[model samples]
Target: MARQLAVALTGAPGPAHRVTLSEVVAQASALAVSGTRTLLGISGAPGAGKSTVVEAILAELGPRAAWVPMDGFHLDNGVLEGLGRRGRKGAWDTFDVEGYVALLQRVRDLPAADAVVYAPALDRSLETAVAAAIPVPAEASLVLTEGNYLLHDAGGWEQVRPLLDQVWFLEVPEQERVRRLLGRRTQDGEALEQARAWVHDVNQVNAGLVLADAHRADLRLRLTTRGDDSAGGSGR
Candidate 1:
């Protein structure tokens, strides 16, 4: 059967780019009630509202859905520091790619009554990963995973693509993404100047890489809050 879904953009640049919250929830609900092991991998450039979209979906689905963020698989600070990649922490190479692939494989198997899986989470304030921060229960019917690397074909990321039942690539305007990223950095306690520099130099470059892989996704979701109302049917 074809996957039934909707793509919308919110916080759009102009009236042309808006995607509303209702559109997103409706699409997620269709997948949730589909009675299959629905795996949705939502990806976006840094500040593309990936987390916000995932949170909104989770809230809508409630206990019926469980989320596993790829951020939790980020390489520890010590590992990044050892490799002299702490400054480029969010890049694909800075992650434990093999570990992530293994987790995705485990999740795809959908074991019953198994011990909960421990997932990593990023502590924005400490700029480090907190181990075992999120738990994936045995009974979750839909697994919603979000990150920048889901569509990445480089290195070990290629291994993660086929594991996803459906992959959603999020497109966001560069300027708004920069603004949101800088604001997030400050909220994480970084100085304004430092945040601006990181957004301009680091995050933007990373976003460019993520955007380059957009066509690989099964569905394309524009990240503006207005929502996508295009009449095209769901992807194959």
Candidate 2:
């Protein structure tokens, strides 16, 4: 199946291939019907459109799939404050990695279970995690998870990759990604100068870690932008 997918995506021989969003959705749909539960991970740097790609996949698969974001495992701000890591809130060590791995293990066992498996969700407006906010039904065969560290290795994060069936790394131009991050922060009422500082001091540091491990992904994707929306995928 992986070989067939590579053939479908257009690009010269390289570490990554160019694929359309429709093709990605179709691949996810195929997994949804595969009889047993499957975990599909979408990973990328900050502002790399991982959520946008996952949203498109969910729209196509509907209830057959469920989304579990890694952000749901973030440590509380108070905890960060006490640890003196509040300034780097999105770094690798800021999350509950072991807890996240445990949830994935439970969710992965859904094929043999009858009860709904509840997962935490990150409430962006509140900037905190809400426990048991997203439910994955026993009938859902495809579990879609996205976040920055799915492909990251080290600090207990090495356990994540083994639980996923397939992982895709999303990539965008550095300028565009930084622009999105800055826009997001400012929209949340952060001052422009402060947002820029946060982007450089915090987000980019995390981005470097994610990008360095891009080669570990099963597939690499670049979203093609049309106006304000993503049109599809394009090759490097």
Candidate 3:
């Protein structure tokens, strides 16, 4: 299924003016009733619209859900520069694997009645950590965690799979994804040539690895420039 097919066939509603508060609440309510705190892993190739989908989900579901993206665990640019990995900032090695694991464990074990657990967020412009951008209140029964490396096998990411109750992988057509990424870089002020080069050299390479890992997901969503289509398949 592709995005066009998804829009045409699924009849999923359009995005709201704000995030979907109700949907998140409903999902979390169900999970809580079952006495389970669900950890949902969302992964997509570069430019597959993962963030947009997640934002919509959160908006629909509202406070019943909380999000702790893997991005918050990104190694600061200064640290990456010291480690000689600045040029490969989004690469799998640039994240704090142990820290991510720790957070997930906390999400799984924390009592449901506690106040709020502050989580960090990534500041793409500064390429550093922004303390407490996401708050996981104990009342939030559904945890929507999204990032490219959720399905990656590198580092200790493999340990993450067992912790997730469900995983959703997004797939966008190669050409459209490339176009979106290039446009995003251009808008960020890179020269056209530099943006193109970055897309080709950095993003595309990482995308390849991400795509290979998509099959490991419980469901694969094909997101075209127009819409989305979902399908199920077994992991190899």
Query: On residues 71-148, what C-alpha lDDT tens digit does candidate 3 reach at each position?
Result: 899998899999998898788898898888888888888886756777889887876989889889888778888888
lDDT digits (tens) for residues 1-236 of candidate 2: 44556453344224544556776788778888988888999998999878878888899988899988899999999999999999899999999999999999989876655688898999989989999999988878899999999988899999999999888888877878888888888988999999999999999999999999888887777655443333432111
Candidate 3 has an lDDT of: 0.71
The TM-score of predicted model 3 comes to: 0.81
Please provide, for model 1 over 149-221, each residue's C-alpha lDDT reduced to its tens digit, 9 standing for 90 to 100: 8988879899998999887776666666676777777876889999988877878788889988877776666
Using lDDT, rank the candidates from best to worst.
Answer: 2, 1, 3
TM-score (all chains, Cα) for each model: 0.85, 0.90, 0.81
Model 2 is weakest, by summed lDDT over 10 consecutive residues, at 227-236
Model 3 residue runs over 4 Å out of place are 1-35, 224-236
Candidate 2 structure, TM-score to reference: 0.90
CA-lDDT, candidates in order: 0.73, 0.83, 0.71
Model 3 poorest ten-residue lDDT run? 227-236
Cα misplacement distance, residue 114 of candidate 3 (Å): 2.4
The C-alpha RMSD in Å for every predicted model, in order, reads 6.3, 3.8, 7.4
Error of 3 at 134 (Å): 1.3
